[model samples]
Target chain A: MDPASILLGGFASGMVLFIVSVGLSVTMGLMGFVNLAHGGFAMLGGYVIVLAMKHWGLSFVPALALAFFAIAAFSVVLERLLYSRLYRAQELDQVLFTIGLVFVMTAAVTLGVGPETQVIRLPDWLRGQTDLGFMTYRTYSLALIVAGTLLVIALWLGFERTRYGARIRAAVDNRRMAQSLGIDVGRLFTVAFALGSGLAAVGGGLGAEILGLDPNYPLRYLVYFLIVVAVGGLGKVTGVFFAAILIGVLDFVLKIYFPKGGTIFIYALTLILLLARPHGLFGKRGT
Target chain B: MDAPHTAAGQLARRHRFQWWELLPWIAAIAAFFAFPTYLAFGTQLLIVILFALSLDLVLGYAGIVTLGHAAFFGAGAYTVGMLASQLGWNEPLSGLLAAAAVAGLIGFVSGLVLLRTHGLTLLMLTLCTMALLEQAANMGAHWTGGFDGIPGLSFDKILGLFSFDVLYFRSQYLYVLAVLLLCFVAVRMLVYSSFGQSLTGVRENLLRMHAVGAPVRARLVAVYTISAALAGVAGGLFTQATGYVNLSVLGLERAAGVMIILILGGYGRLYGAFVGAVAYMVLEHMLAKAYPTAWQLGIGVTLILVALYARNGIIGIGEALLRRLRGGGQA
Candidate 1:
């Protein structure tokens, strides 16, 4: 593949990764909770979209919306019942609880979907490639880049400018202080979790073209998403984006150039980055 | 081994060595020895018991909550399988050693990276390591046989005498049982030693341990590496027993299942790993047989309940019940 094509693919992949990591970044950044089940939500969203498209005959937009709503609702339930209990618990509890949710979600999907690989057929309009000046790329993929960029902008504005964003930032910085100032910290947490979940669902829908809607895709993407989060630092939105794009470019370059030893390259890069900046590329000290 | 004189210490000592402790071990050994006469289920249980024991080294003793231990185990199994199948290294001891070495290397390298971060970062790091390794293995389908797995793994004799048969699982059970006993003894000795205490110390208070001049990071890395080696041994045994190596060995579900076993047995106790493994396999076997479609739901519900109510695991609950019964008798 040409450099332009690789770059485009990397950009598309990076956007999807950004969507996934942002949710994780916000939750970890805002709350001291390391919610491992965020990946499970992504898995749930992917499976839902695939089912809607293949079995229910729903179009892409409707299916995407449905998946997002479903994941958001599930996030609310998770937040209210289990995550709420875990907020005060240690990191281990958060991990174990989320790990349990992963098992339950994966098993449930397997039972329902029969452990077979399910492919989502993109609509005819979005199926073929469109030729740009530099290179030809899939229309869906280019659309993903546009959508992802818009979402990033929207998220930044909401979190950096909006009143709710101010509350969330306040709560994240100091929960007790936020509560003292009469912010509904509990409600804010739920909303934050829902937003994270919603973002993951949208990422799942968009990245389904590249990753495919496999029963095990969530677990597959988990390491990549986690590397992005770790490399960007735990809870910073800007950090997640920069980390995701860097990783995306690196992953694509390796995969295209050295398919045999791509993983080695990826890991080697991570090691170098981590050794140089343990707190992450843009993460503050003591994080 | 002498009991401390303090009231709390005396109570702890008594609690540690109850008669029921011996009963289960005795019953399990007796049943295992007699398993050849009954059925194949006992042998399967034996494998899982060993796997759980390996996990307990890190989870119970070192207080590390790893979600991807199966990487070591699966790597060991694949290494042994590839060697035995392709290179024709049929000697079980040699295969086991190779497995241990490979797993130890991976463990040592990954531990250096993972042990740097605590809490969620550590968990994610381990998970990433497992995922990366699994993908690498899957992509290298020619050598590792990809997703179809390395099949036709055959062994001539375990120690140049015992022949491995597919149908008759009795000798296999004995073979795994013997290995498990050796490992159990090794782990027990380690736990009772000063090294084990150091590991527990690191787990409890790394800062305090460092303050006291203990090399906390080194000790953690050592334990992690050793635990991975033991897991490799278990993986070798698993491949030998099953006569096949599959990608499922390295799957996320497999790792999660092992974690569930650790949680079920009780963390920080040697016997808990064995009990948890047996309990998990038994529950899975029975539940799958009863309700194949929704067995996972049952397992999920059980895990939730255990996490919510049974903080210490089955072994802890058993100890509490025994204490209650003994106190009632005294009353």
Candidate 2:
């Protein structure tokens, strides 16, 4: 493939990763909870879109929106009932619980829907290539790039400008201190968790074509999502964006050149980078 | 509810053989004669218990949580398989030794790099290392057999005296049980030693241990290497007993399965492995027999429930119940 096409493909892939991983970053940073089930929420969103489009005759865009809202709403219940109980639990417990959730999600999906890959049909506008002044790119790829960029800007504003974002940031920095300062840390956690799940939902709905929607989606792409979060330095949006892009681009380009060793290279890279900076690339020192 | 670390030192200093500790061995021997026909399954269960025991050393005692222990297990299995199939060095005893050495070397080397970090990063690195090994194994499929796995692997008799398949795999069952017993004894010794107490200190609080002049990093690496070597022995036993090797040995599922076993059995406690392997295997067998598709679901529910409520596993629950019963009787 041409360099431009590879870059576009990588860019699109990175956006999907960023969208999926950004929520995990938020939860990990804000709540200090290792929510490995983040991918489960994403998988659920993919199913929602699939079921809506297939059974309800809903259009792709509407289905995606429905998936976003539905998963966000659903995750709030999960947060209150399941995740909240484990907020103060050890990292090992959190890991086990969430991994269990992943298994449950996988089995539930398999039992509910057949254990086959679910594909979404794109609208006519997203079906073909779009010719830009500089070059022609897949319309879907361009759409993803646009969506990712817009999401990034929106997240930046939300985190940097809004009062709620400030409270969330406070909780991330120090939950006890934030609570002492009269911040409703619990409420912040709920809202942030919901938003993160919602973003994951959108990413799942959008990236299903590239990442593939199946019963095994969570486990299959778990390492990828984790790499994004860990390398991006926990909870920062910009860090996740850059890290996602770097990983996505490298993975995409390397797979094209050295298909067998591409994933191997990424895994090795993650190991080395984390070893070099245990806290992550953009993560603060002493954390 | 007593923490393992807090009790570790006192247990290590005053630990002596208890009459109750003989129960598991008695049961093992009893099963050998009781079933007589199920040696193959017994051998498999023994291998799994051994594997879970190795994990307990690292995760439960040393306090290093990981998701990549199958790297060592797979390494050992592959080592034995490769040595036997390619070089025709099929001596079962020698093969087990070689497997342990190779896996221990890997553990030592990886531990040096992996032990530098703690918590999630360490967990991720271990995972990456395992993934790296799996990919390498895949790429080196010429020898490792990639996905198809090594089949038709043959091993010589135990000590040149007993055939593996003869008498309904009696020799295999005896051989595996003997090895498991030996390893279990060694583990018991280690866990009750001063070094073991130091490991518990490291696990309970790294900074406190370091401040108290403990070589925390070295202790962790040593325990990790030992654990990996033990796991390798289990893998070697598995390959020898089964006469086959496969890629799933290194897969994430196997890694997770072993961890689940340890958790269910109540890690850090020596007998947890035996209890966990029996429970998990029995549950899995029943689930598979009744509804193959629901097996994964069963495992999922078991894990979630265990993590949420039974964090220390069956042994922990048993301990709690015993304590409550004794207290009520006293009242």
Candidate 3:
């Protein structure tokens, strides 16, 4: 019932959503590929972190880094072998292929680690409540907010200020023209795909406690990711950031009042918003 | 001499009954006698065929990409479930009609808002609509039976003559077969109709259809309603056959499963439902039995292979073989 806690909790949830979904936007908007398996990679990332900490006796921070690098490397291989082949395919084919991947991934995860929820124990510094002068908030939520803000800044600088980021932007704007201008658009795409998927992995590792990791993690949260990307305007980092926060807060607050019908409201809102805009909140007409 | 060359003649030729079309019907009937012990499975196959056919109408023919066609199917099911269990309206025939009506109404209402968007937005909207319906059903657990589902639903005899025989399942099989026949005939007629051709035009190019004054949205809405109604009937039939209804009817898994069936058989072709259902059921039956736990791996591999190599599905592969046999290269 407390507004501050609601805002803090919802904002933290939103940050996780943004981290996981921004890669989807990049793949969907820039590559023009309907990669539904993005969540599968995120799920793998969760498993990577869980396994690293549980079995290897690794610390939480190292496990998080390992999740990012491991999933990133794995995603690059998948991009080259599986995804690149279907770049020119129809939306239907892309959807089917990615969904197929999700199925395989889910089945594999379930087989490997029984069909149970994987819970991670947070370190002392990251657990419990912290006084924010105005009100007390969960230290985990505060950490998520700070970490998410840092990522946003890092992404902004990477995309806006760096030559590589500018090249990625140019490629997304127009592939053929970017290629004609001596940019290796294909290689650029692979790098972007890795980073995007890696970021999703990091998000999954961080949000495993909140999101609940299981065999069906990919399918369970696929909608939230899609909502973030679609409502934010595909490929727009800032747009996804705002959309994720809005959806997260709305979902969190609504659930407090109407536990059973909170998701119903979200779905209805998405229907109306998409019907009116067709594109998204920040999308231009054609793109 | 020029009859085949004229547009009207070509339409007539395409609509004309083919002798080979009778083979499937004969096979369906033959299964009743051949598989006397497997009547229950036979009935399920018929229901799946009907469900897939309904989806083919919307997704394959009308070209609407929906991830939640199960919404209509679930609507039809809960309609039957609620009416029979709660209101004591247990007549099989009337219950099905009510199911179709309720499902069609939902399709019409949702389609009005849903058909406005295209691509990913439209896809998301359809999914949202289904999710909303599922949530509503879950919230109204008292009426819907919640996740436990509406069970112990009893129906009166078909036409008040043949009672449901749980032991033999003969009457259930025949009744479902009859309904499937009627639905298939109606779908065949609709597909060959000028209205159906106009839907194809809309699918091919929405802007061109708009420019040509083809009332694109109305046609879409009409087909969507009809498809929903048919899916509802399938759901109603499922409830009647088993005398049970569950929330899984509206689950995302069912939605995805139906799409997988359509893709396996090759969508856009009228017979795809028949081929796809048979393939899917048989594979699911065998793989689930064999693996017990990891059968989905088989399905996943099949889907990926189909998407990568056989974009058009099994039917497409057959057509390609036929083309090669006739020495027609890539027609």
lDDT of 3 by residue, B25-94 (tens): 8998899899999899989999989999999998899899999999999999999999988899999999
Per-model C-alpha RMSD: 3.5, 3.0, 2.2
Displacement of residue B228 (Cα, Å) in model 3 is: 1.1
CA displacement after TM-score superposition, residue B219 of candidate 3 (Å): 1.3
Candidate 2 is graded, for docking, as: medium
Compared with the real two-chain complex, what DockQ does model 1 have? 0.31
Model 3: per-residue Cα lDDT over A1-287, one tens digit each: 68888998899999999999999997787778988899988899999988998999988999989999999999999889988889888777788888889989988988888788998778889999999898888899999999999999899888889999898778777888999999998898888899999999999989997898998999889888998898988777888899999999998998889876678888888888887787788776762
TM-score of every candidate: 0.87, 0.96, 0.95
Q: Is the docking of candidate 3 incorrect, acceptable, medium or high quality?
A: medium
Tell me, by lDDT, which candidate is best: 3
Q: Could you give candidate 1's per-residue lDDT for residues B63-114 as a string of tens digits?
A: 7877789999898999899898788888887898999999999999888877
Please, what are the lDDT tens digits per residue for candidate 2 over residues B294-320?
677887788788888987789999999
Candidate order by DockQ, decreasing, is 3, 2, 1
Backbone clash pairs for candidate 3 read: none
For every model in order, the fraction of real contacts preserved is 0.18, 0.58, 0.67
